[model samples]
Target: MRIINNKFNIKMISENFGRYKYNEVDKYIELGGFIGLKVALEKGKQHVIDELKISGLRGRGGAAFPTWQKWEGGIRELDEETFVICNADEGEPDTFKDRELIAKDPYKVIEGLTISGYMRSAKTGAIYLREEYTYMKHELETVLELSREKGYLGKNILGTGFDFDIKVFSGVGAYICGEGSALIESMEGKAGKPRLKPPRIGSKGYLQMPTQFNNVESLAVVATILKMGASEYAKYGYGDSIGTKLISICGNVNKPGVYEIPFGLTLREIIENVAGGIENNKKVKFLQLGGVSGPLAPESLLDTRYTYEDLWDLDLGIGSGAILVADEDMSVIEYIKLANNFFHHESCGKCIPCREGVHVYKKK
Candidate 1:
């Protein structure tokens, strides 16, 4: 599964991407697309759970929370009809990994969501697509129909009594909808805003039912773990960062594109080897590991690697793997101003603190 990268070789998740053409279900079958769902059917739910627990895969949308831990809480604790949701809003400024995944291999997301649905014993699944991606709705709908026809989705999938179906909920152009609870709200025909949690999303989400939602990348990896097995996937990453991550590198790079690389690669290595170094041979002043919310890493820490354990030690959150590199000439003040501007516009105005804080900062 060699990737078509402009620069250096990336040793990660792009292997099976673009293998099939335009929802060609037969090609998907031949190339082993829904085999993960097939494997999931054979392995059973507990096996699915245990395998992910061992694989150490986490939510790739940014939080980097363990996959197993999330499922364990919902699957083990509650006894109610659950729903599986996929947060495809992809509202982050620099993030494009989800878009690429869906655009290239829409089936992978379907297969992953289907597997997740079966695992949760869910009867329904929904992908909350961002409003900007409304154009993809027809294509996605076509893909869903194809999946159902191929027996990957719909009632009694693959001759198993695991009845489930999916829908695409094209949401408003609100960045806040990227949050699971907020997405759930949007799905429920309410204003898309983050919910206050004591009864967290897993306990009471999406119509006040037990809901399990994952971002596009995390669910896709569920399919990977089922097919390749946990230990095999675990072999890629070092220590706690035990799997490949889909990184979308933009801004001031020689070759800018998404690359799926294993954990433990330093920021320097990624910018140099993976991305072919800075754009136009200009010196980089800093790198923003995640999007606007992610910490600003100085050029001195270019050696810093992107591992959950290592990043946690630095008190940095990997909020969806969108890396932006800036040259030495870029002013930090201008960066701050731009960030404030985005925050100002995207504040949602649901909360006074968030709204007023940005407004005050702009005034000051």
Candidate 2:
């Protein structure tokens, strides 16, 4: 639960992590907790979306899709029944930022989801909690209850007549359910499996209604963007990839924990300055950005910037923002084998390519 890079001054979500007991509603409000929601209610829905656009806040859930576009689509759908979901089924290996967010600052997520519901006029919001995180479910439920008592949840939030409520649905420990469509399906009481695109989650999702799906980190930042003003938040990150990102660095790093880092920092900077270099002062062998499925980068690629465009250019993705650093003592083949085994076990077997490909790779 260690957080670094606080001195850099770009701590949007992590700003109040250690300042106070954020889990309590009063303490969170003392440090500007639901003020973003209040601002969103005051400015109206379109204003929120516009600010999100100006903020350049892409989806933090690996896809890096435009957050504003999804909200725009949900508004345009014209479906009376719309749903907003916070994808908290963080099954990515070494990625624990979402869990930390939920445990430390559940109110931020609740406010973000409520604001999202306001954006889409959605009555229902869901935080798809991972099964491994079930232990925190009671704590979250208690917070939700407190929010309801405080008039943050249920009908007529903040005297604005914007009625929204959130429910926490624990995942069944299926990694594939981390995908948007599969998460929707699982919520619908079906087996967790990825759904085919075309009727993207924007149009037909969650009981065949227009749904806005956002990752835990993506939704969490929504409140920050609105509270701090989009222009102010947008000034933090690199071009296109604006605002800071929550990166969970582990595997041979001296400081293995989550760090809020501004975009455009080199991989070497993150590994060395941020994570305090490799463990035992060993030389670096390779680094895996995002997660197990993310591309591997040797020491030669350490200079590359961590922006979305830079990673995409190298066929790399900031999937789940999990950085697994391997020292010279580790074997690349063994690492790949471990990753392959994970995929082989986690694949839903609905898609032939992923299903058979993982099996074949495991056999190899």
Candidate 3:
């Protein structure tokens, strides 16, 4: 897991970089590992949610949904048995930031989940790890055990009477399972397919109980917001989309690793400057923001800012925080064909539009 540090990089979540080894519970605690959970416990649930609201942090996994609203929705639900799920299903191509976060700082993610569990009064939390990351399951389990021994997890955490514990659930490598409802379905031991939404996951999910799903990055940031205070965390990014985002840059770029960049940086700066420009000095043909499902942009649109408002205005999104650059060597038809092939093979075949529509496009 390579982290690129630059003038544009902000060390909110990645603050543990170079400071501690992975799985070192004591070292993590030295650097304020469970401070956010402590803060959440001390300040109370509403204070935690209020800090998130003031922080202006949105979901880091594609959708820029307000973090506070999701937590609030879970609170409003009357279910006594609710669940907090961290979506570690990094099924999208070229997006590995979540995996990196889990590998490098699993404790931060655990703390985030614990804070969320406290906020939502959830007794159980789960990490929906993608199957490809099965190797990490053991390490994560080890960390969870250590956290429990140290009183960070398990019954009556820190004497706060908040009984919470987390378990890792691995997916069967289905891309469609990345969807919120579909992920819940897979967690429930059913076929991984998107469910029709009338009662949203916030209302009924995961064993037909109120459930709150948050991306790995989104939940991780929750701890940071609580630790640093909302006003402090909100100082980093552009309007509306506050805080830094972890982007996984691949394809034609020279530096093709995960980067923690502040929002509002131009795409041109990201591709040419942060990512070390096109490989072999080749001319860029197009760029894909988010993942394969994201919209493509020609070189002409490279100057656009990477904010949620800016991307949404152009009918694009920062989905999955994947920036795939294609140079002149790759043809537009070839790229579209490759993307269609992925959808065709990975579609859960639950809906006619996605199932049949993807097949038709692949055949074309």
Candidate 4:
């Protein structure tokens, strides 16, 4: 009973498709879920990293950096304490998929981070979730505890002599903390703000360790790609950018939730099929392709594919994989003003441009 045009039924990492319903473990066992981890335990470490390089998977977060490249940075670094940080802060107003993933399929996220921790021989890993997602934090903590008990986390994972542990850290509600450096800082018990480069997170993060930070979606996909050979995962998306993306459809969509679609799918198709189109069949006047940081695209360009290259052509970004739609009758200026107010209120006063700019807008 699969939709012909949409491949939503296909499971990404497991036969479970990250289902966290009651009795998920028995369901995963019935459908052969977590087999990748089992196979990975048998194959050893290098094979795992090799599978990821061939996936052609770029990060789904706003910055579509190649996942393999990010992993390589930590893998090749000459450091004893390499780390992985799952960015689940989800501060973007238009973003919700991270929270959804955390709440619905926390084990999958943990699985991804666990796999990543194994790949880099990470001493420690953490999921930086926002304090607002209190329920999600609780859910993930339980999953982590379960994983540790199953010998899939903590020392000697899967009896393979791998020692890695994961912690769930809470962010105190700053959008800037969604950035990797700020996330690391907040994890270190400092104010959430960005820092200058040279001694970046990968080089010195989370107590001055070589760190790699990836969004919740990116890490989840990495786990899937690592499990299923890279070539198989690359089959879904279009051209050079391979694999699917989970987009958060909100504002005027009918069936709004986290919809996983291939990269080359058209915006119209996403709106019509994935999101169930606009409310009352109203014409979409403008679309916010990414999060608030992105520019609005005119409706005339709605047919464009939601690929990274296509987005760059429109002078827009796929920030946080957020799709915020606006109706024909809605006022764009007023919407911008509202968004501006949020930025103003959240500014932490450490940076000049963001701090002063947000203050100026607030005064207006």
The C-alpha lDDT values of all candidates are 0.83, 0.86, 0.87, 0.77
Which regions of candidate 2 are displaced past 4 Å? 1-9, 358-364
> lDDT per residue, candidate 4, 1-364, as tens digits?
1123546544563334455452355454345445567666788667766777777767777788877777766678855778888888888888888877776666677777877787677868999888788666666777777677777788887777889899888888888888888888888888888887878888888788888888888877766776677777877776665677788889887888777777787788889878888999899988886788788888998889877887887787677789988888899999999988988887777777775553434555
lDDT of 3 by residue, 1-364 (tens): 1122354656888887677666689999988889999999998989988998988878888888888888887777755788889999999987999998998889999999998888788899999999999999999999999999999999999998889999999997999889989999898888898889888888788888788888998878998888888887777777777778889999999999988888878899899878999989998899998999898999999999888888999999998899999999999998999999998889878888875563433554
Candidate 2 vs. true structure, TM-score:
0.94
Model 2 worst lDDT window (10 residues): 1-10
Candidate 2 lDDT, 230-290, residue by residue in tens: 9888777776777789999999989998888888888998999889999889999999988
lDDT of 1 at 10: 43
**How would you encode candidate 1's per-residue C-alpha lDDT over 1-364 as one tens digit per residue?**
2112332444335666767765687887777678789988987878888999888888988877888888777667447888999889998888889988888888888999998888788899999889999989888999999998888888889898889999999988998888888888888999988888768888899899889989999988888778778877877776777778898998898878888887788788889988889877889898787798777888888877678877778876567999999998899889988988887888777766785564434555
Model 3 residue runs over 4 Å out of place are: 1-6, 358-364
Using lDDT as the measure, what is the rank order of every candidate, best first? 3, 2, 1, 4
**Root mean square deviation (Cα) for candidate 1:** 3.8
Task: Give the lDDT of residue 182 in candidate 2.
Answer: 93
CA lDDT, candidate 2, residue 309:
87
lDDT of candidate 1 vs native? Answer: 0.83
Ranking by TM-score: 3, 2, 1, 4
- TM-score of the candidate numbered 4? 0.91
Pairs with steric clashes in candidate 2: none
| Displacement of the residue 63 alpha carbon in candidate 4, Å | 1.0
Write down the worst ten-residue block by lDDT for model 1: 1-10
What is candidate 3's CA lDDT for residue 293?
88
